[model samples]
Target chain A: MLQKRIIVCLDVRDGKTTKGVKFKGNVDIGDPVLMAEEYYKQGVDELVFYDITASSEKRGIMIDIVKKVAEKIFIPFSVGGGIRTLSDMKQVILAGAEKVSVNSSAVKNPSIISEGAKHFGKQCIVVGMDVEMDFSKPSGYGIVINGGRTKVDLDALEWAKKIEKLGAGEIVLNSIDADGTKNGYEIKLTRMISESVGIPVVASGGAGTSMHLADVFNEGKADAALIASMVHIDGYTVGGIKEFLNKENIPVRI
Target chain B: MKIGILNYDAGNLKSVETALAHLGAKYFVSSDPYELAKSDKLIFPGVGEAQSSMKILKKRGLDIFLREYFKKGNPILGICLGCQIVLDSSEERNTKCVGLVPGNSKEFSHNMDLKIPHMGWNQVQSTNNHYIFKDIPNNSSFYFVHSYYPDPDNQNAVIALTDYGISFSSAFSVDNLVAVQFHPEKSGPHGLKLLDNFISKTQGV
Candidate 1:
């Protein structure tokens, strides 16, 4: 059976790992390399490093961190944020990251997704969608970009389908409404995107407890859950979460 | 001690190289058949489409080199697409592969509810006590990212099986050649352990 993955997402700013609430008020937590190694030791299924300060000025720094993290952690990890060009994608992959995710840039120049997928196999390309609830949109969720600050006219479900067709092997569907809230995952939104896309959908944001993780997997139909505060601040270990999910009869790597 | 990572313009070989470096093993990445042939062991790591990969491998004469190298009985480890191409053929684009092993690579059926690419960690049940699986627990999950799987013509060639809507060979050993449908390099600690076993244990089967 294919186990549902529990991925730890680290938001990196400058060189330190930071966590912000609803993409605001971020505070430095720890070194991403060390934290990544610790979580890798604790048996996190995968790790995602998002360069929160995703600007052209900070790309060199992110690449350096990515190289350091790659050397220490053997598990699969994805690097996102500020990845706008094919050259950026190549630099990250050469730095040893398995997958390179493009979010806002993907929305701006949708061709970047197809270009990245063509240059590197689709498996190497991940489309990180930051979606917010908007009943006016056809899917009732509108695409938000620029770190959830700007709302776009695109529909979430339609965009997901387009990216899949554009050769995005995986979709990291992060609900802006549920992000950093700890209220629980937006199951309705997640299920809609997960069911609509043939590719694997990783439910990101709003993971408060192990139950929430289980709920996202079961009710939300999420293939994987991207967690932050639960493990980063709430003192939940990856192994402990996996054990709880195991008890819940959800297939997890144990 | 020299580990040559065969690079036939397949995909990113950085992860494989980084993993080997972390293992403190001296290695080189090369597409040149002569350079790769000189290594004591060869690690064939690949990603991307089989048809295009075959084109590059043929252009560089890596296909012939790999077959000859396998015939020599030198220890070779194949990962993901590397594992698939070792088979006789692949249902992916109706492509033919290097016939070192006795099977064909078949695509996972979309008719089933599961995703086409069986991506993620899945348990691999060891069918044979092959040395490649030494110290690795039975039913331990390894990271996988692929649409097609190696389907050996001979059941005996299969040393491990995994189920994802169907039972398929996740790992197989035929004499000195060992291949896995999963990426052990990216599979965390146990994955590193498998790579260690492949590198340290000179003999296979």
Candidate 2:
């Protein structure tokens, strides 16, 4: 049986692992390599490095950080944000990222996803969707881009299905409204997207406690859960979370 | 002494490098036939279309060089796409391969819940207890990402088997040439142990 993944997310800026509330009010955490190694030692299944920076500054710093982390950690690492082209995906993968997650760039040019999947294999491409519930819209939730600052009219579920068709190996359903809330994952939203897509779904955002993770796995039926705030603040170690989940009979890497 | 990783413009070489480094083994990335031939051991790692990779290998004369080097009993390990290339042929693009191993690769068409390109980690059921799996726990899972798998004609060539809609040859060893369908480099400690075993076994070969 496939085990559920416990992923630790690092919001990197200028080569540092920084964290913020709801994608604003950022605070410098530390060097990405150091943080990545720390998470690896704690037995995190995977690591996600989101380069929360402008497009121009993203390439060099992201590559440098990937090289640094890849040097210290042997676990699967994913780099996202400002990944615009196939060359960008190749650069990161060559630099040592096992998977490249694209959001805004993939949306603007959806063919990039198919081209990337064709070139690097589908497992190498990850589509990160930043979604929020829009009561005004018919589907309730709308897809957002540019660090969740702009809401596109496209329905979140519709976009997910389209990207899956476009050859995205996995979908990271990140709830913008639930991000940094630390209450729990947006169960309904995550579940909706997970059920809608045939591929693996990684639930991101608003993971607070062990129960929250259990809820995501049990209710959302997610293959993996991406946690940042709780782990970064020492609220829960990766091992602790896994142990907790394991006690609950949830299959997690231990 | 650095291990030479054949850079065939295919597969995830950096991950292989990281796995080797974790085992405290020094390695260098190279596609130069001379550089590869002189190394202690060679890792023919790849991940791409079979025809294109075979084209690159032939254009660089690596195909001939690898065959010659293997005849000398040099230890060479192939991973994923690398493993497929060792076979006689591949269904991917209907391309002929290095033919180092007595097998042919084919695509999966089995009606199963799993998708094509079997991604994520899976366990290997060892066949005959080889040195490569020494100290590695049984039913240990390793990361796998591929669409096609090798079907070896010789059953003895198989070292392990894994089920993905169907049981397939997960690992094979014939003399100095060994290959794995899974990426041991991407796998964790278990994978590093396999690399370490290869290094120790091939150190003086």
Best by TM-score: 1
Give the range where candidate 1 chain B is weakest over 10 consecutive residues by summed lDDT: B196-205
lDDT tens per residue, model 1, B5-80: 9998778898898888998889999999999999999999999899999999999999999999998989999999
Report the lDDT of model 2 for residue A247.
Answer: 98
Isolated chain A TM-score, each model: 0.98, 0.97
State in Å the error of residue B50, model 1: 0.5
Candidate 2 residue spans exceeding 4 A from truth: A54-59, A135-139, B22-26, B202-205
lDDT of 2 at A176: 94
Which candidate number would show the highest DockQ if scored against the true structure? 1
Pairs that collide in candidate 1 are: none
**Which interface RMSD does candidate 1 score?**
0.8
| Model 2 / residue B14 / CA error / Å | 1.9
